[model samples]
Target: MTGRLWGLGVGPGDPELVTLKAYRILRDADVVAWFAATGRESNARRAVAVHLRPGQEELPLIYPVTTETLPAEVSYEGLLAKFYDEAAASIGALLDDGRDVAVLCEGDPLFYGSYMYLHNRLAAYYDHEVVPGVPSMLAGAAVLGTPLVSLNEMLTVLSGVLPADELYRRLVSADAVVIMKLGRNLAKVRDCVERAGLLARAWYVERATMEAQRVLPLADADAARAPYFSLVVIPSATAPGR
Candidate 1:
């Protein structure tokens, strides 16, 4: 019989934020897998490192590229597709051997987590389960002491990868907004927020719920020094102090 595959959301940056189910699953899992940039430690794994027991096989799926511009002949999407295919095959082989694999995710599994790649590839052929965890946006809001939304207010979550004009359009119309993936795209995001006349109201948060957390106005953020773990929040008119 094939062993089950589990996608465990370890929560954003904070080990304490992990759920009871996730802790148990990590401790008992035969194999623990996490994504990381090449030559860097895995944040997902680090979140639950304390729960990982001795003899548990740790798999670091090192990404080939992160934040760097792709060469003309190599497309970023193509590279990611190939990487996911290989990762899925490796995990599938372990499952076929009756070894349960738990893939650790930084936030909620289906909420833009890298675990979705494996899920999409293996779910059709194997039994799988997803355990949810607290996402960074919620944690960031808590740390910033700001409300994400008010009564009847719409909250829009956007990726900094969006086109400048498109981001500007959405920012102007949205009641509240959270911009994520703000590493190299911080300048672009800042421009869009400025164009929408929301720069002063924007708050920037880095590594929320973690030891190295930072919360400040977007105007004070340095685009050149921003890290990938940062987020920008724009409160709605109905929000307190707004």
Candidate 2:
């Protein structure tokens, strides 16, 4: 019989946020797979480090390129396709051996998490299940003591990597906004938020729920650069009584 494949969301940088189901799976899984930048530790694995059992086989799927700009001839999509294909093949081999594999995701597996790539490749052929966890935007809002939305208000989640005009349009149209993937695009996102006339209402959060967590006004964030784990939250204007 083919072994089961588990996609476990460890949650937004906090061990406490891991669900009891995720904890149980991690403890029982024969192999723990996670993604990481080449030459770096896996942040997903780190988030659930406390619960990992001794002697569990660790599989680190090192990415070839993370934030680096691609060359003219090399496309980001092609690079990622090749990487995921190989990663899936490796994981597939383990599954064929009847070894239960649990892939750890930093946040909710379906919510912009890297596990989607693997799922796209392996889901059709494998028996798999995804365990949900708190996404970073929700965690950030919690840390800021703010509500993401109020009744009848729409919340839009946008990637900072979106083009300036698109970002500006969405920012202006949404009742509340969560801008994610704020790394090298911090200045661009900041400009869009400002152009949307929501700068003062925006808050920046980095590494939410982690020891190095920080929440500050978007205007005060160092636009020079931001880590990949950063995001900006804009509360709804029509929030209750406001």
lDDT of 2 by residue, 1-242 (tens): 78888999999988999999999999999899999998887889989998898877899899989878888999888898999999999999999999899999998999998899999999999999999988998998888886779778898999998999999988888899999999889999999999999998899999999999988999999668898888998888754321
Report lDDT (CA) for all predictions: 0.90, 0.91
Judged by whole-model lDDT over C-alpha atoms, candidate 2 comes out at 0.91
Which lDDT value does model 1 have at 34? Answer: 91
| Residue 132 error, candidate 2, Å | 0.7
- lDDT by residue for model 1 over 51-137, one digit each (tens)? 789778988898988878877999999999999999999999999999999999998998999999999999999989999999988
Off by over 4 Å in 2: 240-242
Candidate 1: lDDT of 91? 96
What is candidate 1's TM-score against the reference? 0.96
